[model samples]
Target: MASKGKISIIGSGLIGRNWAMLFASVGYNISLFDIDESRIDDALVDIKQQLNSLESKNLLRGSLNAEQQFSLIDKCISMEECLRNSIYCQECVFEKLELKVQVFQQIDKYVDDKTVLASSTSCLLPSSFSANLNHKSQVIVAHPVNPAYYIPLVELVPAPWTDEKVVARTRELMTEIGQKSVTLKKEIEGFLVNRVQYSILNECYRLIAGDYVSVEDIDSVMCDGLGLRYAFMGPWETAHLNANGMKEYFEKYSKGIYDVSKTFGEIPKMEGATADHIANELTSRIPLEKLNERRKWREERLIAITQLKKTLDKH
Candidate 1:
């Protein structure tokens, strides 16, 4: 397959590896790098295994087979080598603000003005680390959910100085690789996903602390109920469908919703006995030693959902 372009992956961790695979599967040449060169080798092995496993299950992305996609990714011994001739650079380094700032500063020195510099940060705003960079206008955040390859949603959050063209090109690239992209008009702390996620977490913690619900029951409220609809539609769309329309839905239930909201307790600190209780309950159900096994189980389910979505969309 012809190469789309070169994509530089600045970290060899899970997110970086997944990014490399997603780009490589779509015919982009990938330069995978990490400070620890040995980790790069390990990541390549894991990527190979993952691609082959996906291929065996008939869930491999893009037209390229596992071997072909694996061949497009090469290990880089230095940051400059990885960034050289790349059209886009994705920084997946540790989430610490200081570390991210240093990495971007170093990347700014090597990348040309045209390269789209994106970070895979889940929460930290793009401006926080990219503000002091020489190429701040080229920086943006392209946060993806865990198991990015299967989840497919990429949040595109731009810094204030980020060029409009950079954001457009990044979204275009994301589309080209078969990922869904949502753009934020302005930078916000925690972006979109985490803010909504933390809101739910706050209520869950409050309920547990008040002894109003068990940890398992709270999880079931999501996985067994809300999650069923959420997998295909968001909250607003779900509400719209529940009644004749969004207007009617709010008119019918808005007062009751407002009344319940007023009665909800303040956010509970996620520590002390409540944390211990939740942790103990979860650990008993899925022991620490079996976490990796459970993660694979989760991935399998995500892949199934991904396949289902594809089939449903085609119909």
Candidate 2:
């Protein structure tokens, strides 16, 4: 018999499988549910292959071997069975507001008062799709970064009616599964990560639109410069450590920052010729046909960096 504290992951796509594997790594029974049986079957196969690959690379989480962790995941044929006695249900449906509404509504019908109903939405706010649910207090968004197997950051944003305990439990569970989780004080569209990400992207777009930089050079600025320091620390820490301290740092560069900030002006529209030029330049370096292959290559570097961080922290 499976544990009543099982984690139910709805949808067997990349996000869903990643969630299932993360929970299973720490001995949680994972019930994977999907509308398409064939997709579910494919997810299971992909998951096993991923686990084996992680094991060979000495990257598998927890004390358990790949087989032991893989054994903890089960494919569920029905939503009712999947939700039955589950302590948490993470909905990983396609990104559509209407689809999220339908999924949360149906899930609300089958969950207990204690079950945490969370969404894997990247952009939608909780109230947008879950306001009318019977278990509104239990609904929240636990958005994970893509390539979750390599990245550990997850943002937990709660609805206005969400119970405080729900936020606490979600954070605790994420921590237990080796993920770095942050909970928002309230819901916000796109949450925290994407907001900062877009701020950077907006600047990149402006640079390209004004012919100040090429697409490739902008990427190099991130990959070879900002990202190098950002891997281990954030902007705040970077500033604090760069000078004597925060106060001295501000005194020294505050005017320079203000002057540079003025030039940013308004965000670029990024339509028509600007968009076409950027797209063409990117496609030249990484053709659309080889996106998946590139993603794998990117994840491999991320994994190596993750390992390096772990080793450095021990000293």
Candidate 3:
């Protein structure tokens, strides 16, 4: 855990490129590594295109032009070249356990003693990949939400053997790159955010499957109701602010919430009629022929929302 300076990114995919943009935007020299040399070339192209997109939209940080930002990203052809003199490394490889294990083993072999080795794994835990490595204590999951170039919530998940010092340094480094991080005290399946997301998803599935709502209507409920409020306050904070305080809110709603929770049905298999409904509604809004255009629209909308959130927080 040297202070944030030179950083390395392994697996230059979507998340990897985002991590590189994040660090480089803050003036860190970055080494980006990937097995396919062409992927490095492609990532460099994609990142510049992405940075230019942000620049046009005034979403990127710093005053660097797209060319200057592109220059900060060095395509490291070898693992040795990638880790050389790097203070920290962020792994954004695929989510498979074996693939992660293999990558971590190689990374541990090349990493400096003080370098913090972090993963952008959404599912695999640190112990699942780094347990047997010599640099195990330095390894942890620093999972980022996609479009990390704009939306910057990094979930800091440390395994049982991951050192406290390493976690602190990781959190500090992420903050330096203008990323918000929440540290998990103990490892849990899907971590905090994904678990909460999955709970809502399960309920959405049940609602659609039980014929209580259409798939499109279910999504509209979130977009029109819960999601708008979530832009300002989290569920717990909303509960606290709704009444006098958290205690009073819980006292009044505990039984009701519990009863509703108990009455919730099991998750649907999502294979037959439910799947058809979802497909029909989703395709209506975003036809397969226009998927790429729709994806761009979604990303832009998220970026706009993120900008709005920043403006609101400033006041």
Taking all chains together, each candidate's TM-score versus the true structure is 0.97, 0.96, 0.94
Ranking by TM-score: 1, 2, 3
Q: Deviation in angstroms for 105 in model 2?
A: 0.4
Off by over 4 Å in 3: 1-4
Weakest 10 consecutive residues, lDDT, candidate 3?
1-10
| Candidate 2: clashing residue pairs, number | 0
lDDT of 1 by residue, 11-96 (tens): 99999999999999889999999999999999999999999988998888989899999999999998998999899999999989
Q: Pick the candidate with the highest lDDT.
A: 1
lDDT of 3 by residue, 75-151 (tens): 98999889988889999888899999999999988877789999999988778888899999898899998777767
**Which candidate comes out best when scored by TM-score?**
1
Model 3 compared with the native: what TM-score?
Answer: 0.94
Point out the worst 10-residue segment of candidate 1 by lDDT: 262-271
- What is the C-alpha local distance difference test score of candidate 2? 0.93
- Indicate the residue-level lDDT of 217 in model 2: 97
